[model samples]
Target: MDHLPPHPGADAAESRVAARADAYAAAPLLGCLLREVARPVTDEPGVHLLPGCGKLLRVRGGRRPAAPEVRTAGGWHRLDHAELVKLVAEELRRHTGLSNHELPAEMADSRDTVAALLTARARATAPADPYLRSEQCLLTGHPHHPAPKARGGGPAATWLPYAPEAHARFPLTLLGVREDAVVEEGDCSALDALGAAPPGYRLLPAHPWQLDLAAAGLAGAFADGRLIRLGTTTCDTWPTAAIRTVYAPERDLFLKFSLDVRITNDIRRLWRHDLRKLIRTDTAVRAAFAALDGPAAWLSDRGYRTADFAFEELAVLVRDGLRGHLVPGATPYLAAGLVEGFDGSPLDGPADPAAWWEAYLGRLVPPVLAAFAGHGVVLEAHLQNCLIACDGDGVPVQALFRDAEGVKLPPGTDRAAGWERLVYCLVVNHLMELAEALAERHPGLDPWPAVRRELARHDLPEIPALLTAPTLPAKTNLLLRWTGADGAAAHYRPLPNPLAGA
Candidate 1:
């Protein structure tokens, strides 16, 4: 057979996809390096000096920076994603005086994962529901993390079917744990509604991906009759931005499971310690939200169920559904999703930018502050943990916070530590990202002033120091990963606070 010539159109399309993936992946990696370690040259625009290597690095664009180049003896050399990863690894080694083979590979894996997701997304149809669409729209996640999309450096085939970015949805793998082996806490009655459990077994729905990942460890339980496969859920559940959590609109329930994969900062497994403290943390948050006089709500992590043998691995948490908490005539969208943006995002083309931003701040800021000041419950109000509900006109009217596992309570966590955490999650992580996105979309919008005013309205003692502080604590994800720090242990670097002068 004669060899056929390669089609120019197809080749060009593939090249475009690769280039886009590179840009998408590079933005977060560059943002992390610049924010966490590099110092900018005051006189040179777009140029930053990597203090570790004493090298000048430059990038193009803000918000989502791109086109990374390093200054060499001969001149400047642009780097592809692979070269960028190598550069980052080398810089980190020099800066931290540590050699880490793992993080560099994760950085590469994250970029490769983006390429795969881009390709998969092109073939898949987007979810019709705007909420689900918003949840799945994060192509470039955690803008300051080195490996936001790294799925344990596994093959795409292993993770893509369950990936939110791919707009993928699948049924939960239903399993039945023997009555004696079943371990549960709090209200897990909603779980029984998923499917029927035979005579002496309790219905335990599991993430299929987790099952595959831990098959070897779970073999003894399966073989010993402690756990048995009971088929799958009748309705498909959409995976949220938090990949391990799945939402079933039909049942109006959220099921969080243990996935033995390193996503961003953690392994994403429901740790035993956190699981044990679920009820206490959730109760504190619930009481705080109930006492507050507003539309802000809390999606309680009602309870969790697991096999006694595989407590952490098989654990699945049941969270309160949306319908009951959301305001009438309002539609809920993930806060992180709003920043990432989707087809129906309210952030897109707002009629009145100032009014829109004010409404958003009104809905989001108060509950977080009240939860801390009034009730001593520090809610993790980071972007991923929050949901904003918009009315028919797409004006934000409500803010709902979830994930009791991330919440901090008094005594156990000192007041000062909890306050610092609240500021980081609510102000630095959540509001700052949203404000940047809004300001980027609408050039004249000065979101910090509204943030300053909204925060000032809150009478908390920390408010004054927060507003005038020269710098704010920003989590150092890149350095954390490089140093192999405990994923839950957060390290921070001071970032110039826009709130200071605003």
Candidate 2:
């Protein structure tokens, strides 16, 4: 809540709000850069030797570090969001010897987007449904990614209307694709029920923003009468934290669209290659969940439909909703939303913190490990990819995982690499963040003991080594972005493992 004194030209309240957002936006970027490109000055408590940027930097707080200051002859000078972006760009330029005008712009756009979202959220009422509120709760997403809120450098007017962070909801743009030009696989009959199509065409739902972006590409299809415009869906779909995916309350189904914007690391488009392999990956995961003993379920990405000529641009993925997959009385909440901190989060109201933590570990950990060890399927069980379904008392009883495109199959993947990813996603990315959130709420209680006990109960061969290991792999998102590495190619650095001695 504390901020440096206001500038002479800036209003006090506005300056404070801007400073708070600047800190929020800069924290993740600074964390990534400092971890990967800078050397820790072990002698100094919060100082780093930033060889890339050619300046020593100091920051307070851990995980999402804040209050960044660069050393100078006069003293340590605090940097605002703009200065921080300049520093980062300079660092990447010096380190890579190449300039990227685009990423720097994206970084600025991300911060500005955060500011706008904060203002909008202040005026708007949060949804009463816990699940919907959770979906709209990600203000500063991907705590370690530099440009988590960046919307491909688009204007606020264009992106804000569809942004989940702003709690925006709109009906899907329905389209009629001629049956002959329609390319589909698996059971996509659920899509047809959304809206009625013409005599010779089938119904296809599209993300409004995506349709706008691909307008140029689809002009020919429309002109040639291969594609026809149908009116919007009668019911509105709620945009999830994953901006491209939407949840239809009336139909109890989820639809994922091929958005062209770059969210997190990659362009948020359903690539043809991933689409081709979707069925195989989803089937494997579905079977694994079915064989598991407990309430853990997999939200299968059942199938997709698209026009043949504009396949990737127009593809829409059909995923199983909460209707059939969820436990009878349990309420499901996105795991990332739990990390992001929402009003009705389970972390907010657990009568017995220790018992609650244990139950959470019990539901979340087993299925991910089982899927990897027994079925040769490595699930991307990160915060956003998984959901924790809790009972009325806010005790977690089940975990539902989604996104077949991110699942990795064994034999095709090296065993060690697969294990590392599973550990990073399930343990480091998912559980560690959740544990931190819990500890923040109840400071005296340590959640790691429960985590250790849960892992010990698992009979996997890797558990012993994991328990004793000094460090766990943490993904280097900033370095990867700076170097222009493929987003899917994960690069990691070691982080101190909390489970090492527990």
Candidate 3:
């Protein structure tokens, strides 16, 4: 790996962008103590590197040390770099309390230890999710503060706007800013509008590159709040925490907390809980599902991609379910936690198959269709969000709807925003997850087939039958079955995965 040390003060202008990347402690506190450590020369690796910030690693071979081979962030796999000079630069700053002028490359060879530790850390959190401990870089730029324009394209999605709730605590909007941009006491204030600032609440907007540095220390403190620090459905602000949220099995709720007062979608959805008909999208979606005449229940949620910190897409979090709330009639398994996908976490583990699900379709699908046909309100009656609950042991008792977020209604018939949302929430997103699980778990069970079969079994209308025609392509079939054949998109890739032999 190439090692170049440009003195900070001698070239502040040169260090502007690179400085934005605060020097960090290696993974494992000091990382593996190899020959040397490789530090980030520039922040915004993807953008800064032009074609994209790449993962540059410095590995030490037995006979020859490893050279830094750059790989694009899109699919770069390894980070075995050894000459991370920034770590030394950061330590100097912390020890001397100096700006670029203070950071000195001292005793120099702290690598063998830093590298080993860093590698261990990477392996520790490496599973479906990997652990990432990073340092920060001080950068230079014109930060919008509250509204940072999105990189590449798309409109700048400004979340965490000042709200009535933020009256007490100043609403801090994260800009694409660097270190110098942090004005002294920028967010330290008590607004005459908002009463007392919550004791533990504080806001500090840093450059997107700095979040890892912040997360290594602050994430612990943020978890202390009853409603601790909120994160954007988008990870652009901080990839570490964003990655954790997406992969954690615990957290299941997310919100963009949009700042634009006019862009009040999150607020509207949250407030809809008050209105009688739309008390909860969960409830509405549940009712809509129960209304459907089918053995298939809505499964996965579109909101739950288990979040990715790439920040390439909308980081908006649609609050659809309340975690921990239990449905008495539902199985405890039904009361299971939800993984907000890449973005959130509900309960834990999925509803138990042996302990929660009803017997086979022969007996189960019949009553389910009958229930919806009778009421015309399949409120989250799908297989995923809703539960096939039993009494004490593992006897399937009833189809209990747990996520009172989305309630379902018959298609073609438009209700209110609440109902339309219910259709989207239930039939589309929620059922879709369940359909995929069923397809994945019990291949030939035929979830959509069950949906249609249930409709015919009941006198309910055959509105969803358009999905099973032949001529459909393969990618569509995969995505459809993959997502559990949701309500609306069920039309896109009509062909179902073959359930024949297996």
Candidate 4:
């Protein structure tokens, strides 16, 4: 991590800046701690008992919990970011009977990365467009993940140039693969229109960061006549919240590239197995959406292209652009951005907070449940994968979903396991988080009742039990990272379900 210079001069100001980074970093870890590990002492909110450790932890409660403190013998010890990380590590060690050196380091790296981002953003200007600005405003991502902002422990210089939070944009490095060497499936013809290729080669665009990471392996291909460098795109492409996927406004296309760095739980490379199963998964989702009523849409993963030798390293997926799928006058906003917040967000100040919440639940919930119950297709309808389109009044009119790589179909996925995933993704991850954000903005407005009402409207047999269930399965992101578990293997801890009575 780069030791970013403090605000102008004043050593005092520098100390304050460092403290702010620590607080920003601590919030997510604290959320994970409270959700996954700690036990509540009383009905009183924000206070929890760290079992077997003989300690009490308290935080300012909300979607992004902050200002953590630990009760001690002498008095209450306020934890700075480093102290908090130490506390978490100690607690996990005592609780699990295992020590993980890497996660704690990642926790620190995440803090340092936040500090670097804050420094860079202070000098940078945010984009004027609300949608693009929303995509760039996720400074503290995945509210429940302990190390959401860590850049694979790489130097700031290596990753900062491509960071979405830094509001960075760069032209993709175009490559020409020998006709015989190119391997692709489905409709990758969209890639060819980006740039022209040589006589017997096909045009393939690669994320500059991916190219840098894979440069050593690609050297052999370049040495031989198998691959040719064709320079970069004519215009800059904006990276969405998912850093590997970029949006080209001029061409109205989305390109998802294979990145070697681990953003959150996974290496983030487009694996060969997932890419091979993509067409089948995407086709099923497309058919599900087609059968559904109303304007809800699926931004299909049209196809992908790559080199035969370096399949996963060079793979790039083409996704449907927003322009075609969006309703006539509505503006599409990334659902995750709406939760993380930017300058302009519908949830910021809804005309009728209750009505807005209803419309949101109405549009977003049905398709996910319908896809699961009716089509046997479980869509990863989490916030980042969803886009909610709102009209002039900031009322949600349409819902569009993307990313087929995360989709799971029948037989390949066990029935019980698939339902668990749907409930986790749709209710716990998506609705619950968005509801918290909305409720935080509009005090006294309970968004879960509307969520309950929306779920009740659907005829799936699971709906009744879901409404009466005492606990909801929340993903154990912090522990999963700590234990070095497979990213796709989700282990959950029970959380108090807000919709239990509703």
Candidate 5:
């Protein structure tokens, strides 16, 4: 593994920060390795036997496991973040008969990125808005993925100013697309209100980071007068957990841009193929939510606008603001943020753990199942894509799901395949993480029973099989990255189902 050199002015405090960053980075990588590649040794708690090299691996803690160690001829030796990466690479190569040169570097980069984020977070003030605070609280993102914090291996300076975990808020660079060169669909009239466009031009807002990354491809357009630079937005926008997407409080708008950076599993560009089908997918989700009888809501992706010449590179998608869909006086918090605790998280200390867990399940589970069974639409109800809104008393009153780009329709994808995708996102990625967090916070609280009961309440045909199934499908993120598979092409392995006997 290529270790990042120590900071030039490193001190005792910086050394402590490095230690914390190592712990933070190692947890997800360890979780991924244990889940996807290692098997538990019978009657040995926290001990796993690697099948490939017959090595015994041990870790401490559950949920976010830490302090990985490997038993060797001499004795048991602990592995630091770099050594852990090396161990993982060796094990994966022996197990899969393949060598991955890139993932190790990403693992190192992720660790270095965490170190930078930790330092920045210490110096920066947290957002006063609870909702914004919740959105920006994901320091250890995607707890099951190996390199969740990897920022395309770029220097920290390039991405730090836009990182949500650092409490970043900045103005967007506005541009003018020549009237005839503008491409748009659906309801994109909201873009016009951001700024004034000169005669024969349309206002186009761009993420400054994306503009910087795509500067080479866009130079010709700037010189040829197809795109002109306008001044930045007067009001600043907050970057959400999804770094490319920003929330503008001044206009009560959410704008998603085509970022060139690879965050978590994918290079998060707004690809043209997905954009062409955006309306169809968003409409299906909207109709499903409209027909459902509950407090569940769908935040619509209204439309997108970009220059025809630079479609994917310059695309900006406009999404619905929170005010319209949220329950009266209810505050919405990112579900992922709730798992990764924030200053004012509702999950931190609920008055009644049972009631809170049930209320959470009641609000979140129904809509996802209903969308799939009742309307043949599979909503990506993962934690990051979901927002749970709480009433004045800290009760979960509503569940709002967004990101239409991740939605799957029936005929395009077979029902069985779509159902599998839904199960992974909704049950595994979303509920399992929340359940673990809730259970960890409140000792002696068995979260599985409530989850099983919630699944039973749903009338969908898949519920019975899901509740009784011995194993639930879990996406193999570590193996996927090691094998250099396409990020969107999900590969799942069977994980023991906790709901089986609950």
Candidate 6:
């Protein structure tokens, strides 16, 4: 090669160093990233007034100045305490924009991880997972056994070779051979089955570092002593659903762009009341609508030394960030996309009147009522909020409660809106979804009885028997499109169930 006057590498390296220096020198950026070496922390005046003392985010300062000192910085800072909070939040938001943008190579995959995440979901009615070892991933696959048989089969019969450090200090399990492939339970497989290698077959759980590439821009712990970029390769645990973008250097997390956020139940009384301000329609009175139509704030409530919510310490490397603890796995948790469900009104059309009732009144009702006494929380028991998830054996074993927002507690017992919203959220809203799902599954089952049983289980104060009820079918018709025969869909079909007493 022709000898250049100077190797470009030297100049490029110098340029990078100078640029970094300039970034630190920038006052606003520097100010936001400043840390308090000795300042006394101060809580918001009214922050302690709120329940759980609305999380106190660490202030970026050498030490929090005294109230008088902070006031002197601007006595108005004291006058507008709420405004200070608002401004800090706004400024903290600006800091999410970092000095540099570097897409990490570790979590990158040619095929999106969403394909494998289909099974990462937690069900309202969870099926018994046989793959999960009783207490540990000890080979022999039993919970307590440390035998090597759990890792017995070779690459053809199984994948994961005997790796001591697989996950949770336990070896990842191989369920069976599928299509000449060693299908590792609760993990990715097809990649290794492509003849990758012998030991390569050992499955790797989601690595925590992936968050640096995945989060909007590592928020927490970035502005402190060291700018630690925390991210989650959210796509790594997902095997289903579509991902629009990981959007590195742009957004922190990957979202199913098409999802509707309104489904999440918001509990703020102000937001709740403001919804029905203009309309008298029942549509204006619903709970799911509030969650779906929200510009909901996604924040980490847990506090840490990090300027922002110390997501680095709290966000699981592999677990779904929001309401993710519901799923169990190693510390290298599986990732579930913080996605919104597509909204088209899951309850808009009824499949079969008799089936709907059979599912609603028969199979689904009895157990849901029992959920209240069993769980200490009367779940919203609404449509779309309950999964009715089944196990490998196709039996309902658990009810995955989606929104704690709509849960019920007897009046004077503690909980806003007490029982009014509770009844609606639980029996009316949540159960409707269960009823619709049940009817779709079994057409012959009577939904009315289950409704009665579910109500009975809850000790309902009143029954629709004497009152002019909204024609049982019409009650559900408003939600579903399926109408039973005779142009009048209010009919009965009993759902099949062997276990009633239980």
lDDT of each: 0.92, 0.90, 0.29, 0.89, 0.93, 0.25
Per candidate, the number of residue pairs that clash is: 0, 0, 113, 0, 0, 62
> Which is superior by lDDT, 2 or 6?
2
**Which tens-of-lDDT digit does each residue in 27-131 have in candidate 3?**
211222121123434653321121122234433222112222334456443333233434333433443344442112211222221222233333333223111
Per-model TM-score, in order, reads: 0.98, 0.96, 0.30, 0.96, 0.97, 0.29
lDDT of 3: 0.29
Cα error, candidate 4, residue 387 (Å): 0.6
The residue pairs in collision within model 1 are none
Per TM-score, what order, best first?
Answer: 1, 5, 4, 2, 3, 6
Highest lDDT: give the candidate number: 5
Deviation from native of the Cα of residue 271 in model 4, angstroms? 0.2
Reference-based lDDT, residue 346, model 4: 82
Candidate number that wins on lDDT, 1 or 6: 1
lDDT of 5 by residue, 1-502 (tens): 9999877777788889989999999999998999999999989899999888889999998799999999989988998999999989999999999998999999999999999999999999998999999999998999999999999899899999999999999999999999999999989998899999999999999999999999999999999999999999999999999999999988999999999988888999999999999999999999999999888999999999999999999999999999999999999999999999999899987899999999999999988988898889988889899999999888999999999999999789898899999999999999999999999999899999999998898788888899999999999999998898999998999999999978
Ranking by lDDT: 5, 1, 2, 4, 3, 6
**What C-alpha root-mean-square deviation, in Å, does candidate 4 show against the real structure?**
2.4
- Candidate 4: segments with Cα more than 4 A from true spot: 1-13, 43-45
| Regions of model 5 farther than 4 Å from truth | 1-10
lDDT of 4 by residue, 473-494 (tens): 9999988988888988999989
Stretches of candidate 2 exceeding 4 Å from the true structure: 1-14
Ten-residue region with minimum lDDT total, candidate 3? 135-144
Cα lDDT of model 2 by residue, 176-266, tens digit: 9999999999889999998899899999999999999999989989999999999999999989999999999889999999999999899
User: 501 in model 4: Cα distance from truth in Å?
Assistant: 2.5
Candidate scoring better on lDDT of 1 and 5: 5
RMSD value for candidate 3: 19.2
Point out the worst 10-residue segment of candidate 2 by lDDT. Answer: 8-17
- In the range 1-502, model 6's lDDT, one tens digit per residue, is 8776877687875555443322222211112222201122344431211111222322222211122112333333331222333333333334333221111110111001111111121111211222111111111111110110111112211211112112122111111111222222211232233122223222222222223223355342234322322222222221111111111111122111111111111111212222212122222212322332212111111111111232222111111123332223211111010011121212223444454343324333444434433333344444423333222323332333332223343442343333333445444434433443454445555454555544554454433331223422112211111111221222221222212321
